[model samples]
Target: MKQQSEMILIGGGLIGLSLAVELKLRGATVTVLSRNQQEAAGLVAAGMLAPQAEQIPSGPMLDLCLRSRALYNDWTRKLEEMTGLETGYWPCGILAPVYERPDCTTLPQTPETPSYWLERDAILHQQPGLGNDVVGGWWFPQDAQVDNRRGLIKTLQTAAQELGVTIIEGITVEKIVTSPDQKVTEVQTNQGIFRADHYILTTGAWSGELLSIPVYPRKGQMLSVRVPDDFKSLPLQQVLFGSNIYIVPRRDGLIVIGATSEPVGFTTGLTPQGVETLLSDAIRLYPILKEFPIQEFWWGFRPETPDLFPILGPSSWDNLTLAVGHYRNGILLAPVTAQLIANWVLNAQTDPLLHHFRSDRFQTLR
Candidate 1:
C-alpha cells in the first residue's frame, strides 16, 4: 500500500480549514496550524457568494468565482451532513439597486447566470423596504450567501476535525524551512518544527510575511444588526448591494451591513467613522434598517494581491503550494480552491483553471 501523503497547512481560516477537510477526505494526513481563529478574516466575513452581483468582469477571476459558487451547494450540504450543523447556505439571490438608470452594456452578465434589470416598480415590489432613492436594480437570482460568522466557519472547522484533520490553533508560523533542492523540508513555528511531505500556505493577509508573495492585507469594517421581534419577516429578504455598502439579511433576524475597503496594512479596530458610514449608507439603501438594533462591530483583513486575483498553484519551492490572496471572495471561493489544491497535492494534476492564478504571475513585478 502507498503511504499517505503528510501535509501541513498554515492558516486555519475558511480557506485553510476547507482545504484541510478536502485533503483529509482524500486520505491524506493533514495538520493545520492556525495563528488565531478570531483574527481570521473568514470569521468576520459577510459571506456573500455573489459572482454576478459583485460585477466582476468576464475573465479568469469571474470564471473562478462562478465555478466556486457552483460548488457551494453540494459542498455546504455535505458539510452539514457530516457535522450536523447548518451552514446557513441561503440561496435567496442578490439585488443590486441603483439610484440612476444603469447602463446595460457595462453589466457583468454571464451566460451561466444572467442578471435581469428590475424597474423601479418591480424592484419595489421585490423589496418593499427599499429606500425611495432606489429607482431600479439588477436581480441576480442565482447569487446567494452563507452565514460565515454563525455558520460556515464553525461548520468547516467542525467538519475538518471530525474528518481527522489535526488543527492546532494559536501557533504562529515563524518560517518555512526549505531544502537546498527548492523543496519545503519543514515549517518552523512558535510551537516547534513540524515536518511534512508537502506544505500549503493559506495564510491570508500575512502570506507576504512568511514568503516573498505579493499578498497583503486590505482591511474592511463590518457590522450586524438584529431585527425587532415584532417584525413578521426579515426587513430585507434578499442581499441588497448598494453603491458603497451591502445589506445581507440572515434567517435568524440578524442583518449584516458592511464594509469599507481601506488599504490600511494590518491596522485593526473599528473606527467610529467607518461604523457611521456603513450605518448611514445602509439606512439609505434600506430605510427600515434604522429600527434594527446594532448587534456587533468588527473588522478583518482581506488577503489581496496586486492584480486583485488570487495567487494559487505551486510556489518556487517544489513541495510548497501557494493559495492566498483571495481578497473579499475568501468565503465564496473556498470550495473550489480546496478542490483544486487538493487535486494538485494528491494527484499532481494541474487543472487549466489554475493557469491565470499561478504564483509566478508576480515574478516580473517582484
Candidate 2:
C-alpha cells in the first residue's frame, strides 16, 4: 500500500482551495493556510472566462486559458455534484463591441471556438441595449463567465471542506523555511512553524513577499450594479467586452463592470477617478447601465509576472511548487492549475503544458 502525500498549501484563494480539493481527491492529505480568504482577488473578480475576448495573441498563455476554459464544464459539474452547490458557470458567450470598423487582426480564432464578426443590426438584435456609437462586434461563442463572488468562490470553499481538506483561515504565512539542500522543511507562520511532505505556493499577489519570485500585485477596481425590477427590457444575456471595460450580466440581474489596470503596489480602496472612469466607459458601451443602481464597490490585486504569465510547476526548492501570478485569469485557470499541480505532486508527472510556465523561466531572462 502507498502512503498518502501530506501537502501544505499556502494561500486559500480560489487557486489554493481548488488545488487543495484536487490534492485531496488524489489521496493526498492537504492543509491550506489562508491569510485573509475574504480579501482574495478571486472573491472580488468579475469571473470572465474570456480568451478570445481578451485578445491574447496566439501563444502559450492563450493556449493555457483556452484549455482551462475547455475543462470548466466538467469541472464545475463535478464540484456541484460533490457539494450540491451551483458555481454560476454560465457559458453565456461574449460580444466584443467596436465603436469603429470591426477588425479581427488582433483576435486569435481557434478551430474549436471560432469568433466571427457580427453586423450592427445582428449585434443589436442579439443584445438590444447598446450605445449609439456601437457599430458591429466580434462574437466569441465559447467565452463564458462565472459568478466568482456569489457562486464559484463559495462553492469551491464548500467543496474543499467537504473533501476533508483542512483550511485554516486568518493565519498568515511569514516565511518559507528551507534547508541547505534547497528543500522546504517547514513554513514559518504567525501562529507557529508547520511541516508537510510537500508545499505549494498559491499565495497569488503576495507570492513575492515569501520567495524571490517576480509575482507582484496589479491593482484592479471593479463595481457591480443591478437592474430595477420594473425595467422595460430583460437584462443582458451575454458579456460585452468593450474598450478597456467589460460588462458581465448575471442571471439574477446583477451586472459586473470592471476594471482599471494600475501598477500600484498593494494599494487598497477605490479611487474617485477609478469609479468614474469605469462608469463612464461602461455606460458608453451599454447605455442602459446608467439606469442601474450601484450595488457594490471594491478592488483586488492580481498576481502578475514581468511577462504577464503565471509561474507554475516546481520552484528552485525541492518539494515546493509554484502556482501563482495568474493575473486576470485566476478564476478561469483554476481547474487546469489544480490538475497539473496535483499530477506533479503525487505521480511526479510534469505535463508538457507546464513547459512554458516553469518557475525558472524568469531566471533565463535575467
Residue pairs with backbone atoms closer than 3 Å in model 1 (clashes) = none
Task: Candidate 1: count the clashes.
Answer: 0
Please report, as a residue range, the 10-residue window in candidate 2 with the lowest summed lDDT.
Answer: 102-111
Query: What TM-score does candidate 1 reach?
Result: 0.96
Candidate 1 scores a C-alpha RMSD against the true structure in Å of 2.6
- True-structure lDDT of candidate 1: 0.89
Off by over 4 Å in 1: 1-5, 105-111
- Candidate 2 global CA lDDT score: 0.89
Q: What residue pairs clash in candidate 2, if any at all?
A: none
lDDT of each: 0.89, 0.89
Instruction: List ranges where model 2 is wrong by over 4 Å.
Output: 1-5, 102-108
User: How well is each residue in 260-353 modelled by candidate 2, as lDDT tens digits?
Assistant: 8889998888899999999999999998888889999988888989998898999889889999999989999999999998899889999998
